[model samples]
Every structure is written in C-alpha cells, then in structure tokens.
Target: MNPAPSHPYRAAALLAMLSQALFCFRLSMPTKLMFDEVHYVPAARHLIALSGPVNIEHPLLAKEIIAGGILLLGDNSLGWRFFSTLAGTATVLGVFAILWLMLGRVRPAVFGALFALFNGTVFIQARIAMLDGYMAAFTVLGIAALLWAMRAESSGTAWSRWVLGSVLLGLAVAAKWIAAPFVAYAAIAFVAVRLNDARREGRSIYAALNARPIGGIHRHWPGMAAIPAILVLGTVSIAAYFATFAPAFFYTVQPMTLAKLLPFQMQMYGQQTQVLPHHPYQSAWWTWPMMVRPIWYLYERVDGAQRGVLLVGNPAVLWGGLVAVAGCLYGWWRTRAPALLAAVGLWLGSYVIWAIIPKSLGFFYYYYLPSIFLCVALAVSLDHFARGTRWDTRFLLLVLALFALFYPVLSAMPLWGPNAFHFWTWFPSWV
Candidate 1:
C-alpha cells in the first residue's frame, strides 16, 4: 500500500475524473441511440420544448437533464447522450472519493475507478442516453455521502453530510424506482450502527436508541442532528422536482394526453410484472453474477463491414467480482463492521427485489446498477490482496490491463458493422 500522504485525496480525485473523462470521450459520438434511445431522446426533446410529460413513463429528472444538454448542444444525437456521459463521469469520480473515505487507502480507490472506467458494461452505458447511468451516479453519490455521515463523529459537519446524502438519495429514487431498496438497506445499516453504540455504552439497546442528543436536540440522541437535515434534503429534492415541472406540466397538457400516458405507465408496470412467454436473450439473476447473458444494446454494419462490439462486462472482473462478493459476505460475518455489512446488504437488498416483483419484461440490462456492488466488492478483495504480496499487486495490474484491452473490442463492435463478429460469442444468449 502506498504511504498515506497528508493530502493525497485531492490528487486521487483528479485522476479519477481524468480517467473517466477519457474513457467516456472514446465513444461519445459512436452512434445513435441503441435500444431505449428511441424513447428517451424524444422524451428529452419534448422536455426541452416544455412539452408535457404526457408521453413519458418515468419521472422528469432524467429528461430534464437530457433537455438541458439538448438546449445547449442543439438537438443532435450527441446532445441526447450528453447527460449520461456526464453522469457516468461523475460516477467514476464519486466512487473513487467514496472508496478513499471508506477504505482510507489509495489502491482500493484507484482499483475501483480504473475498473469502472474500463468495464465494458459501464463504458457502453455512459455513451448513451439512458436512465441507468443517472441512477448509478446518484446512488453511488448517496451511498458515499451516507458513509461520510457514518464516519463523522462530530455534530458540526454530520448534519451537512446527512443532508447531502438525503438529497442525493432522493434524486436517485427519482431517477429510477430500483433505488427504493437501497434506502431500506441504508436504514438497516444505520440501525445496526446505533445498536453497536448502545452495546458499547452498556445501556439498554432500546433506551440507547430512543435517547436524544444533548442541548440542541433530545438528550442521548446519536448524531441526532442528521435526521432533520436528511428530511430537509429530501423535502427539497421533491420540491425541486415538482417545481421544475411547475404549472406548465399540469396546465399545458391536454386531458387526453395525460389520461393516455397514465395508462401506458400502468401497462408498462404490468408488462414488467407479467413474464413474457420467452425471450431469446432473457437472462436470470444467477446468470448476471456469471456474465452469462449480456444484452447487446446496439449493433450495426458499417459500410457492410462487421465492426461492432458486444456489451458484456470484462469477464475477469465480473467473474472475479462474484468471488469478491462472497469474500465481502465472509468479511462482514467475521468483523460486523458497517462498511462490509453495507456492501453485502446493498448487493442483496438491491437485487432481491427483482425476484419478487412480477415484472414481465426484465432484461439483462437491469443488472447494470446492482453490478456496481459487485465491482466495489471486487475492489475490496483486490485491495486486501494488494496489501499482502508483490504477486498480488501484479495480479491486480493484470486485471486492469485485461479490462482496458478488452474494452475496445466490446465498445467498438457496433461501429464495425456486419463483420463485427470476429470475436466469438460463446453463449447463444449473448447475441
């Protein structure tokens, strides 16, 4: 491990930003929207025109972002993708900062940032107009802020951290519904932290929990100032959301436009719940852990030449990540530390919800956000090993190199046109 410098964190943040920017820049204008781009780009244009959200199924947050980009860049293909590219870049930097604050080391943070930068899945998503990137960015930021709040013992900055965490969480939820489970996971983690404090103080757990803080708040409250700040952040995000839409949304759209839109959302929700007869590329959750079914968001024949790429994750990273997650579970079981526990909770809680939901049209792409947990877990594992032996450091470097080498093949395949299949697809579901 490198020596911890008096102020090494800023340098690390700059590297993360530069790495992500370069990675995103590689394929920014590669091609038009692949799959869902058709729907999202139009929605963004509508949003820019102050068109009612009548045609859109999701919240206005992502559209608003895309709209901003379009307004500035002009309504071109690149314009629609601008926000996702920015969000993807932000996600890389945020993850690096979070890992640094949580792990208190440079290697783990660098491993995560580099891995995310070269990960085929993350790379492809960053270059498109998709809600997933926005969701990932905000969720990671929220998790990082929450971790900061937990680590801060002093009341002075804790409230501010909590407020930032809450606002980010709210935006994350607004971006995608899947963010709900993360909230539950966070709450559970916080309660556990409270319990730990109570146990240490030799007080009744129940009393310790309910006890208030001194002076400003209830006496005995543990970082009690955070709750109000969190509430304020939440309220503000929600208010900001509605405020953006304003009377223009409700007053402008025709009654039928909204009526039709509401039913479409319900239908989409219904579509999500009802299992399709079968999809050629339908992937099970278990397969995701193994990278068994990678969705090809876009594929095209350039000049009748096959040159497009696949969208699967870096196999080494994804496969190793599975092992890493297991290791994370073991670490949490043995140590009971908040960080390890939070990793496991996030991995399980975010994904397990899909098992119960009756969504009919679930696809492999749905695994995108949850895969981040695996990446972080793998990073944790790599960090552990990197601190152990020279060979371990070599192994980690090998993985990063492999990720970078393979990234081009996957990301550039679509640009290759028809002959892009030079790289073999081992699984039928991959096509």
Candidate 2:
C-alpha cells in the first residue's frame, strides 16, 4: 500500500469529505423525527417563529442552529438534519485535528478519525436533529484548539488559539450543559500545565511568575499570568454562553431580560436537576465502557418496511478501544508521553465524570463524547505498538467491515423484518 500523506490538512480534508458523504447519505430516510428529535425539532421551529421556549431544560444555541437550517431549507426532513450532518462532519475533522496536534503524525490522525467515523455514535447522532452531535463537535474542536495553543511557537499565534479555544468551549456548553465539565477541565488543565512547567524548570514561584511568558505572551508576572489569563478567558466563555440566549430576549411570549438572566439560569437548573423515572435502555456509568446496553432510537414499520436506528458503538472499535486505552495508560505511566496523557485525559473528563453526576438516569448515547476519545487512544496505541506493520491496515479494515455490517441498523435502513435486528444483537442486553 502507498504511504499516508505527509501533509496533515490534505489527509484531514480527504477524511472529512468521506465522513460527510457517509453522514449525509440517506440522512432524510426516516422522513420524520425520531427519539429526542420529538423535543428538539419543535423547539427549533419555535425559535424560528420567535415563539416561546419548548425544551427549556437545555440551552438555545443548538436549536437556533437547527432553526437556521429550517429557514434556509424550508422546514423539511433535510432542513431539520442538514446542520446536524455538518456538525457530524466537523466532529470527524475535529478528531483528526486533535490526534494530529497531539501525536504530530498523519497516519495516527487518519486512523483515529476513520475509527471515529465508523464508530456508530457520531454517525447516528449526525443523522438526527439532536443536541449531542453539535455539543460533541464543539467540545472536540475546543480541545484541538487548546492543544494547538499549547504548542504554538509565537506569542500572537498562541493568544489567538487560546481565545479561539475558549470561545469554542463556551459554544459547547451553550449546546448542552453536559459540555460544562469539558470547559472546566480545559481551564484547570491549562493552569496545571503552566504551573508544572514552572516546577520542572526549577524556578521559584516568584521567579516563575516574573521571568517567563505564558504561551509565549510576555507578562510582567509570567508565572502568575495564568491566573489573570484564566480569569479573562473564563469571563469570555461566560459571555459566549450567555450570548446564545439572545433569541430568548426577543420571544413573542415570556421574553427574557438581562435582569432575569440569573433567575432564568436557576429555572434551567431546576429543570435539569429534576429526578426522572428509569428508562429501559438506561445503562449505568460503569456499564458504558463494556457496551452493556444500547439504545434503539427507532424500530418500527416505516413506509411498509421494517426499519430501525440503533445507537450502539461499533464493537470492533469500541470493544477493542478499551484495551487500547489501557495500553495508553500504561504507556503514559512508563514514558509520560504527552499524546497518551491527552488521550487518557479526554476519556476521563468526558466519561468518568458521569459516575459522579447526580442524575438518576443515564442512557448509552451519553457515552458519545468518550467514545470519540476511545478512538484517539486506539490510534495512539496503534502508533506505539504497530506502526509500519500490516496490523494497522488490518485493524482498520476490521473496523470498516464491522461498521458496514452494523450500518443497516445504525441507519434506518429496511431490514428483513422486526426480527432482523437479532442478526446483529449478539447479547440480550443489546436488545
């Protein structure tokens, strides 16, 4: 086989185009909203009409984007799903960029992104008009920008990347409160890295504060610069998040005002925090990594054909990714490789935190963000253990084959009958 391209952007663009074509293929097949689209699509319509809120439990930016799609495309199935397809495509690119920035290689980046594309969660979420697809896209893009800022060679370039990261993270939270943890992780990680650098250089706290630049930006107290920089960036993120509520201020009914912002936030919090009943497809945080249960978004007769959409991870990627993540953790312990550290950190921030959240119910689809990072870990592990060998090619082919095998259920493609799902479900829990 020919070698992967040396140019990162060239390789990333090709992968992105492929992902977009796959995500957009048969996107409007269901011809109607499925699952949570029942809630979000109507909210998008309400936003388009300047009508009152419909799904106030979440923030507004994602719905606003969907509304913009409807306005541009005349409120059809394609309109409801166009931006989602684009967000899903961006997510594919974001994964490529994150691995590229972290590992500084084209092969791992390409492998990681292809794994993510074949991973069922991103593909399924992209076809539906839901919040998680947009949220996951912004969260990964924010992480990629932050990784770029850390390695930037010039002060101006670093500052621009930092600001861009902050804005993207803020937009992520505006998409859904589930993204809030990632923003917090970004802030804490930035400060910790700067402080660790100071300690590593054997500089006194005082000298570290006064001698060096933060991300190459000159500061009077360079060590202490992270404090003020974080403060400013935090404010910027808050401003970006609140800006998404702009449409709320103009609602034809029950308009929101600046004075009411805090109270509105309280209301949103109350709505999100309410204890809910259990769902049949709900899986515990611990069960997620093992793919113990999968959510069936839709499974019914459509247009006189048996059709379904299952939000399950590609087993070849997800099941194998667990071993890859463990390998990454061991590699990080042995060598402290920055790429391994990043892959592990992304997984922890997105997945482990779910264990501590107070929500009474959780679904398998909530594993979406962490699954993306799992692919990253798999890429890092493969680069370390199997680079320049045929295993890399073989593993990718395996993932692709499994993706194709599961594609029928992952999309709403016609099946032999309701029992056709049994062909793919190897375990009872998956039902």
Candidate 3:
C-alpha cells in the first residue's frame, strides 16, 4: 500500500532523518565538557595540535574522529562533539538498516529504529563525545554489513561484505577496548557455522578416529570461506585497529609496532588498578537492567535552574525488553529461527560479559551496548505476534511518547528547579 515493497528505502530514510533531527535537537549545550567528554574532547584537541596522547588506554581512532569534527566545525562544543553527533545519528540509521534487513517490512524497520533511538542509553550516549556511542555505531554497522554479506548470492559480493564488516568490527573495538569481546564473538560465530553445517549433512564424529572422509564437514559455506573466514576477520580487524593509529605515527616513530605497543599495553593494564575519586552516581552492572542508579554525565544548577545528563535507559523500552527477551528464548526454542537466535545470542552474550569482568571496572553504562540488542529482541517479539501494522504502530507511538516525556531530562533542559527531574526519577536511586 505504501512505498514499493521491493525496497523500503523511503521509510528507512524518513526514520533516520527524523531521529537525527531529535539527536541534533541541541547540538550545542552546557558549553562545556561532561563526564567522559573531558577525557575525549581534550584528546581530540591535543590530536589537532599534534601533541602527545591524553586518553591513551582507549585507542585514539575515535578521538581522531572527534578531532576531525573539531577541524570541520571549529573548536567549540559543537566541533568537539560534531562527529559524535554524526555517529549517534548514524547509529540510529545502522540499527534501522539491520532491522530492515532482518524484518524486511516498513513498519518494524521504522519502529525498531524508534525503539533504539528512544532507548535512553542510545539517545544520551550518542549525543556526547564519549567512546561508547562511537563503539556502538561501529558495531551495528559491522553487524549490518555482515548480515548483508550473508545474503549475497555470489562469492565476490560476499567477500566484499565480509571485508567491510571486518573493518567495521576492528573500528568498533578501536573505539573502545571493551568491544574486544565482539571479536571473539566473530571467531566463535565462524566455528559455530561450520559445526552446524556438519550437523546438517549428517557427518559422523567417528570420522576423526577412522579417517573417514568428512563428506559434508569440508563443504564450502555459502557467502564466506570456511576456515579462512576467521583469518580474514582477524587480519582485517587488526589492520583496521592499526589504521586508526595513523595519527599516532605523526606524533611518534614506530608507534604502531609491538615495541611501543607492548609498553602501552602494560601501562594501560597497570593504570586500571589505580584508584579514582569516587562518583556518587556510579552503579553496579547487575543493578543496571533495573536502572537502580544512574551515573550523571553532567550536573549543574544555573541561576536557580537545573540541567543535567543522567545516563539511564527508557523505562518502557528497558522494562518491556526484559519481558521480551523471555519471548525470544521461547521463540528460538520453538522455531529455530536464525534471526531470533542471533538477537537472543547477542542480548544474552552482552549481558553475560559483565559478570566475568571485575566489579571494579563494570558499570551500568557497560549495559548500554547490550541494551541496543535488547531493542532488537523486543522488535523481534513484536513482529512475531503477527498483529499487523495497527498494533505495532501504536506501540511505537507509545515509545515515542516516553521519549518526549523524558527528553527534558535526557537533554538536561533548564528547569526552574530540580522538581522536573523528580517527575521523571521514578526510583530514589535515580537521584
């Protein structure tokens, strides 16, 4: 009934454009660095001047992106944060692209983007100059590319997609070291594919002992080379990581080599143990899903008015996703849907990563990445209901309503007093 069903390009574009406009609502505010912006904005400034590194533990690629923003927009809050503005907006588009690819419908494609865009974490993180937003942007793009590659009908098309995805994956990790786990996910995914292929072809495990030729064990995987796919992913990712270090080359000779790299790694590893001044808003990872506490990225009372940035997920989306994930698990068990499995796998895997990390390093913000996938999981559940456009559209409107209600606090809009914050702060811990 709408844009040609052959492609929902117009709907996707409308969704992305509108979301970008919301994220760009106040491209310049506070006129000063917020929490981690203090770490990254200065690094970008230092980068522009060709000075030594500032936030070295995290790679400089994303900072370089910020620096490019500075170069293009002039060294104001907007300039320092311009690329982040772009990254944050692009993340919405990336999520939309992935959803469109998976669901292949206009309603879910637009609603999925809306779900993620309104996600308090995605909304807030994308607007600022922190690595989390950029990391998320690259990751979704990488995933979109990988999924596109898998759908390719020809080897050439598939290889191109893999190359693009690998580079994006490397760029994703370079933005934040925390994303390194995704690389492991990539490798593990390759192994899982081969194992599944063997299972489908009825290959026997006894072949290892009997030297029986694994008839289907070595069958060529569609769209990607079997064993070598892992090598390609690893190699391209490492290359992508080093390429972001290009700015380092200008500042230090042999900066990308193992000689300088190993020492930097050791220093970064050592610095992780150093104590930092305590933050009042810091929260444990387990408490994040419930949003028991929110870390304030910015807080100030100006002339009897209050404006602050509190990193918290949207209540409806977060609470609903919590329930929808169960539906995902149930659906995966029932239908063996690959998309369902991928969504559930990523949602659970991202949360499970926090448990293994030392509590000292874990925070509610670490939950941000997984929360993006949770939106996907939620969208998957909605699509499964087969309720058609009427129900899903209304649900999307409800999500947008929440975003509108929370936008004042999400953007730290000036309020006569702290009273407005209280309206949205459902939990005492949120204060």
Candidate 4:
C-alpha cells in the first residue's frame, strides 16, 4: 500500500461535489413518485403531519429525514429526493475513505468512488425517496470509521472512532433492517481482530478476555482492551438504534410508549418476514450478481417521447467486479493483505448474507449494498494489475464511457419511443 497524500480530503471533496452534481441533474424531471417512492414519500408526509404511523414495517429515521427534506423544500420531487441525494454523495465519500484507509493511496480511492458513482444503483437510489440510500450511506461510513479505528495510533482516537462507527452502524439499521448484517459484521470483525492480535502478542485466553484499557496512551494496543471494545460496540449501537424511535412517542394517535416498543418491533419483524405474492421483478438472491432481473421504476410515454428509470447495475462494473472479487479472495489467501481481506469481507457481509434473509420477496435493487463493495473490489484488482501502468486509469475511463452510454436509460431521459429501452436492455432477463 502506498502512503496517502497529505491533502487527500481535497480530492475526496471534489469527488463528492461531482457526485452531487450528477445526482442532482434532471432529478426533478419525472416530477412524480416512482416505484417504492410511492410507499415512502407518503410515509414521510405522514411524519410531517404527525398523522400517526405509516410504513411501519421499517424504522423511522429514513422517513424522518425525508420529512425534513419535505419541510425544507416543500412537498415536491426535490423535497422527496434532496436528502437522498446528499446521502448518495456521502456514500461516495465513504467509499473513497474506505479505499484510502485500506490501500492508503489516493488514486485507487478515487477510482473506487467513481466506480460507485456510476454503478447505476447508487445514482438511481439517490434520486428516489427510498430507505436504502440512507442505509447504504451510513453502512459505508460506519465501515470506513471502523477500518480507521483499527489502524489508530492512540487509544483515545481508536475508542472515539469505534464509538462513531458503532453509532453510524446503528443509524444504518435504523434506516433499514437490511443493514443489520453489516452491523453484525462490524462487531464480529472488531472482536476477531482484537483477539487475534492478543494471541499473536503471546497473551493467554484469560488475559485476552479480561483485557482492559490502562492509560490514555498505550501505543493503541487494542488487544489489551477487547472487553471494553465489545461493550462499546454493543451498547452504543443498540442505544443509537433505539434512540431513532424517539419521534414515535410524539404521535397523536396510538402514540408509542415503552410498553409498546417491543410489540412494535415484533410487528416490524412479522411484516418483514411474511411471504408475499410473487411479482414479475422479484428475483432469487443468487441471480442478483448476474443481473438476471432489474426493476423498472418508471416506463411510460411523456411529451410524445418514452422516458424510463431502470434500477440495474452497470454490466461492466457488476460483471467485471465478480472476477475482481474472486481475485481479491485468492490474493488475500496467498498474501494475507488487509485490503484484500477487507474487500472480501465487505462482499460477504453485504451480498452473501442475503441468501439467508427470511424475506421471501427480493429484488435486484436489494443488491445495492453489494454493488457498492464490488466497485471497491474492482478498484483493488485494477490497482494490483496496474503495478506502474495506466490500466487502472483506462478501466476507469471505460466505466465512465459506459456510464455515459447508459445514462439515458438510468435517468428518465427522453428516448426515441416505447422500444427505445430495447437498445440498452442487453439480455431478456434485463427487460
């Protein structure tokens, strides 16, 4: 890994600004709720009116944020999507930060975040009033913070980073339960790393279990503080997750109380786990990585032209990323490189776990979190192959070209006619 530049934040800021510009462009073109937005935007409106509860199957933070956007911008397209746009940009920054911390290089970080920006899922999710975008943003930010905390040089800084990471992961769950797997991964990874370090330093099992922070300064030997670390992760994350329900207590009708919280949670769990009628776009978990099916958020004629929004990953990024992730897994086995291991762990946490989720109905968009990490794996693979060449730059340019090519279909850009979508739908499954 190369040393990061002293001014990495400047580059990260520029990338985020670019992402913001792209996400905000033609954002209001549809001027109407699309797909799941119809479900969520109304929930946000109800929150604004304190009109009891809506969309109770999910948590409240995401709707609260959407309500805040509506209050600030009024109930319009922009209002529904503005915070999602910001969350999307933050996810870009989070990807950049994760790569920078893992690879300790600016170039690969930029490439990784750019790949995420054009990955199709982020751009589409960011433009809608949905819960996944916020969940994804907080998920990546939490992972980045935890990664940094693992490398911290001081105990105080390490603890602070861990606490922040825990809080962010909690917020991610508060947005959507899909993020629950990531929260579990964070705690497990942290404890595993700490215990491994302790064993490597010749500590006994009892000592490892009893480890506690000594002074404010101890060369950041987190191995000596595994107990406190686990406690902080669990306590802080659970507290933060429950704190998001505070607004529920203020509702005028059937206001939530301490006694109702557990029942409300049970209701959410029951709703989430129940099987639903099959839909045309519902897909099996295994088919997601192959892009076998995509959800058509909008497809209609407007102003004598066909306009559509397709929630699909960029073929180049999603397909090529599979090979890249495989390479990362192989590279990690051989070299035990931290960056490669982190990439694979991210893929497993986000993608593989979905196979066991009790939810009977899944969609292509459910692969959003995995697609983000696929970009990271691709960046790592490209950087390894570059090895003093411009291969990474060339691949990035190719991704950018494809992003441009698909922008019309991804955005609600005017097309030639009803059959215009056929031009971009490469496979029957995609259609």
TM per prediction: 0.85, 0.94, 0.90, 0.95
lDDT of 3 by residue, 195-283 (tens): 66456666643331221234422332254544567788889998998778777756642344546765776676566555666667666
Q: Which residue pairs overlap in candidate 4's backbone?
A: none
Each candidate: RMSD: 4.1, 3.3, 4.0, 2.2
- Model 2, 224-288: lDDT tens digits are 35665577568877888999999998999999899998898888888887998877887888999
Local distance difference test scores for all models = 0.65, 0.84, 0.75, 0.85
lDDT, residue 129, model 4: 94
Candidate 4 or 2, higher TM-score? 4
- Whole-model lDDT, candidate 4? 0.85
How would the candidate models be sorted by lDDT, starting from the highest? 4, 2, 3, 1
The better candidate by lDDT, 1 or 4, is: 4
Question: Which pairs of residues have clashing backbones in candidate 3?
Answer: none
Q: Is candidate 1 or 3 superior in lDDT?
A: 3
Candidate 2 Cα errors over 4 Å, as ranges: 1-6, 206-224
Pairs that clash in candidate 2: 209-222, 209-223
**Candidate closer to the true structure by TM-score (higher is better), 1 or 2:** 2
Best by TM-score: 4
Task: Write down the TM-score for model 4.
Answer: 0.95
Error of 4 at 273 (Å): 1.1
